[model samples]
Target: MLAALIRQAQQAGLSPEPGFAPKELHWLAQLHSGKFTGVLPLREGKKGRQVARCPELSQPEMMALPRVLGQTQAAHFLADSCGVIALLPERAGQEVDAKTQAKHGAYAALLERAAQDLPQLLPVLEVLRNPAELAELRAELAQRGAKATDRLSFAVDGLDLLESELWYDWWRRFRRQVFGQPTTTGTMLDLSSGEVVTPAKTHPKLNKLGVGAMPTGASLIGYDKEAFSSYGLQAGENGAVSEENAAAYRAALEHLLAQAPVLGQMKVAVWFDHRQAEGQALIDAIENPATLTQASETFSWDDWDDTEAIQIVQTPEQQAAVAHTRAQQLLSALRRGETPPTLTAQYFALAISGASGRAMVRDWHTGSLEQLAEAVATWFEDLAITNLSGKRAKRPRFFSLLMNIQRPKPQSTSMDDYLKPIRNLQLPLWRAALDPNAPIPFSAVAKLMEAHKAQVMTGQFSEALSRDGDGEDKSRIYTRMALLKAYHNRKARRQLARGQGGFLMSSSVDPHHPSPAYHCGRLMYLLANVQDAQGSDVNAGVVQRYYGAASSTPALVLGRLTRLSQHHLAKIAREKPGLALTLERDIAAVWSALGHALPKTLSLEEQSLFALGYYQQLADSVSRRQDLAAQRKAAAAQADPHPATSPLAETTQTEQTAQGE
Candidate 1:
């Protein structure tokens, strides 16, 4: 049956090559001789006999048939066609020859069968099955046979065995063979022209099968072993090499190259463990100097002009021009009584701005002189009432205003105690006016004028009186007035003396007259009456000044009272010689109180002088009183000659004289 099938296939234009051997032929002859049955049927149900077997053979013959065939052919269609007879195992050692013949024979038989069954397969068969008709096919098969000398080669050669519909269609159109011989494919084929050239056919199965035109001695051209290993390909694996793996490797290479530009420029010292050939290939492909040059050309400045220049130098004349322009603008604004935007403008154009430049503005507005004056005047009026009480006045209102005005710069650090309160009030008021809502009291304003008067009295006053000439004049004037008022009021009040007689006698002017300290108290009383009658004139500087002066009178009067106490002690001592002892004790009590007050009252220089005089006078008076007391006691003890002559009476007279002395 196999021989008859071979003959039938050959008759139908299938070519049987001489590669067939004795064993394969014998296998076919046995089938023709009815020595074996075809295949066994497991179940007895369907067609013909109850125990179905080959029609021309017995059960034993059919059983022996499988044993006669080799495992390779037994698994394939060796007995089905004579064209495939050469593919059966004829000799144990000729594996390569047998396998190649088997593949070609199978293709021949398939083509012939296809031609007979489907007329559409005729053209493809004419080109592939008959060596006489398709010389190229015969040559390709021979080339494939020569190449398939090893396992890898055989696997590659097996690619031609793909007998699918698309392969047949490709065969019909191009009449080209790519199985063994190097024929055109992949960009080389002109499929549109129907030319017998290699077509660019990316065969999915061929790629998956890893069947290339030839075994690339070192694996498919750019196959990455490591990548293939990731896909389960190890050192030794069975079956055909997967074309999918090859394609995957190619795709991976393309991806790497696409990312090369960015990676190449990265400052990473990449290292890899690869076979020398692979490493070298990667280095050569990625480290091309030409690529770097091309990349760098993208930013080269070929069209730039180096000779173009710019001038940076500023001339003295130009600078002077700028200064003059600024000066003129500032002067114009100042003349309009407008405050300059900045201190620099104010200072440079002060002369041209007139009084406006020097005018006191609030400290919140940068503390100009005008604002300080206002604050001082306001605080001075507030301080007036306390200073008039004929008691030592507590200048708490002045201290509070000073604290407010000085803010960050303490007044004590910058001004004398006499002038500090007034200056402090003025400075912050100047700052306060910069913001309209900021407080600027009438008392501070009044004190400002008084401070001006105080400045006039002090020799420390500046000659820069005109605000237009110098920016500091108004500040200086305000400072001076505050100092002058503080000093004048302080002196005037000191002239009034409070005593048992309502006021002390002033012996310097009139021995029997009341002291200027007493008069100061009267003046203060009169000023209080005037203030009570007139409502506080918030705008009047004169009212504030007089009020400040009158208020300070009591402090002066208290100081005079202190001095008067010492004076009376001296007068009593001079008037009663016998009472010197009593006088001395009273005087000592007065002196002790004065000693306690003196330190606080006197300036450093005055304190030293006064302490020295007080101690000196105290020592002299003590010594003289002691001597007078001793002399009187001695005389009383000597003899009363008239001795109603009680020793007790004598002693009593002596004691009385001593006590008087």
Candidate 2:
């Protein structure tokens, strides 16, 4: 991994050379002929900042300045604060302590010492030694509203001292004497020249502890405690990796993180071995496969450059189909014995979280891009389930799938607390999406089930089945059913691996399914429908009253509901015999499918099947109702082709004749 990272950084033309790193300097200290002129802000609001190849020393470099509690070593170059430059007391109005005074002297002394070798540093040293000039520096900063803590670097005669090679070499030698020798060793792929090289022997010890652009104290390879030390290794001696390799790896990771997709507190860095892969495209393909399929038909290579032709394709989606279609085409080329641009490249992903101060690597994934695409395609296929319209429902985005498990927020709960479960499930769920054979986490299914049951308890069934303007059935409910189906499909896959057959849930209701719990769920929905058909407003109907009991202890509640359903059926028979008979037949079909006796109590898995069966039955019934209504309308239209001269018009004429008589 470290070798790969070093290669990546070198290939990107980023110099990961030891003893030097990129730092953003906030202010530029203008100087002329050994005299302080003024300070200028490197960046204003919404403006770019100046970056310098500053000298970095130590594992975790000291902030503000390079000084310890009692030690008075000045920051060699690039002090981050006025306090370091002027030796300001720790607090305002406080007297300068002896240690601070020593640091002040050391700051000038280091420059004086460096000036001997690099004559260009002599002017900067002269300004640092003058008290009046230091006071003028403070006054200039105060006028510009610059805080004492802002980072600033010096410039003399249009020459940035930090960017000077002479200063860099001087600082490198000083760092070597203070810190120990560089221990980096081993052959690594030199991405720059595309050859293997020993960077340890060629580069200096210049690695710093941090993840991205910001330098952090937290370490991924720190041995701060005695217990962490072993094999004759002492504390602070990170024997696992040399500083040079670590720096290269850090630079590579930082590059990846700069463009990685983020989920909650985690940032996922995805890349191809040869080139950078569009991570969002992979995520979108998994989240909404149908959209990619639709986009492919209209996506043209020519339209890419025609702004007017592709004007509708803008931010976020931003011609998303291009990536998806191109990826598929590349994969197709490989299968057809043609050389594809991205043929046979491996996909790499690393998910990391730095919320705990220490950097934590949550997951590392690697696979052929072909396998990744197949896995994502398989994920959507397994999750296929019908909507309330009895059509295949849209797959929710990956984030939406996780969000479905979150409990309804209470007024007192913080957003962070409410989203904790979703955050916890991100890594496992992401892994599942990437691995076709991996099962959806059982804990995730359980949480979703709990949420589903809670919605039932609160009489949310009607809302779940409600139609939206886009003709989509209730999205949250559809997501729930899809997740349930996926859970069962994965379980079946594992069971097949074990040489056993298991029930697999389909996209729509299957009346021939053998599970009594499923049929019971179907019966539950049918009974609820019968009660609703009575045309009476009941505060709490069958689903709200009996769902929990029926889903858990089917034997106890289903039989009672079946008996009560007869009364509702009888009322419907008196008013609409055809509808009553249809309901009766539907109930009989569900009972016929239940070949086994109803279990006394359901296991968690069985309960999920029950919910799936219930939702699918409802969706099928809705489709039937829609089809029946459309059929009736068509029949009426056929029966009276000449609607303007029909029975109603004749009846009105007869009534007028009677009035005349």
Question: Which pairs of residues collide in candidate 2?
Answer: 19-206
TM-score of each: 0.16, 0.74
Q: Residues 334-423, candidate 1, lDDT per residue (tens digit)?
A: 334554322211000000000211211111122332232232322332222211111222222223334322222444573345444554
Provide C-alpha RMSD values for all models, in order.
45.8, 8.1
lDDT values of the candidates?
0.29, 0.66
Candidate 2 lDDT for residue 309: 21
State the lDDT of candidate 2 residue by residue for 1-661, as single tens digits.
5566676777666656566666656678889877888877886773325453666654444332355323455553555455667654445556667755666666666666667888887777777777788878866766676655566678888887776676776777766665545444545454434344443322222123233313433444446666765655554342444455666766677666665656655677776654243334665565555445332322233322211222335653545555555555433333345432233556777777663446677888888766675676668777788865567888677767777765566889876677776777888878888897788888888998898888878877565455353332267778878888888888888888888987676789998776788888888888788886542212246778889999999989888878888998898777767778888888888877885367799999899989988988888887766555555545655886666766766454433332222
TM-score of 2: 0.74
Please give the TM-score that candidate 1 achieves against the real structure.
0.16
lDDT of 2: 0.66
Highest lDDT model number = 2
